[model samples]
Target: MAGHDLGFQVVYRGETLEYYRPGGWVFFQRPKDCGGGYWLGRTYDGVFMIEYERPVSLSDGMDFLASMKKVEAKSEEFDPNYSLF
Candidate 1:
């Protein structure tokens, strides 16, 4: 979580997605390989990462992620460091 700050890079499959932290909200675009769209990125705070249903524009995805939030089983409950969403 070192680069969770605004404009930090989130890397997946060698692809890079930029993240933004406005106020206490952290959002990042999901890699296409993992299914594209923006997600409510993980935070050091209590907020858990949220996934999107369909691919979306980065700005719109970020804006709507909270409302689109889904319930996911906590990683620590079943599999360590593994979130099922």
Candidate 2:
């Protein structure tokens, strides 16, 4: 698992899987497999996009995502809008 400042990003290639967790909301892209390549991205507005030439297993994708390390903010700078109440 990896750590970032936002939320979590999970990556799976071949038999290896990696996980990343940041402090913000978690987001993910649909998995894809093709003879050439695939592309996926999340927009700043929270829109997720996935383009693939072949189908991918949903179970594998979810498993990879679920393995993301849980990360919590250690400082107030992580969330300026946080309320103590």
lDDT of 1 by residue, 27-77 (tens): 455667777755544454434454444545556654554343333223235
- Which whole-number lDDT from 0 to 100 does residue 45 have in model 2? 42
List the candidate 1 regions with Cα displacement exceeding 4 Å.
1-23, 41-56, 62-85
C-alpha lDDT of candidate 1 relative to the true structure: 0.46
TM-score of each: 0.31, 0.24
lDDT of 2 by residue, 1-85 (tens): 2323424343334432233222332233334444322222223343334422243344443444345332223333466797999
| Candidate 1 total steric clashes | 0
Q: Per-candidate RMSD vs. true structure? A: 11.8, 12.6
The Cα RMSD of model 2 versus the native structure comes to 12.6
* Cα distance off (Å), candidate 2, residue 61: 0.5
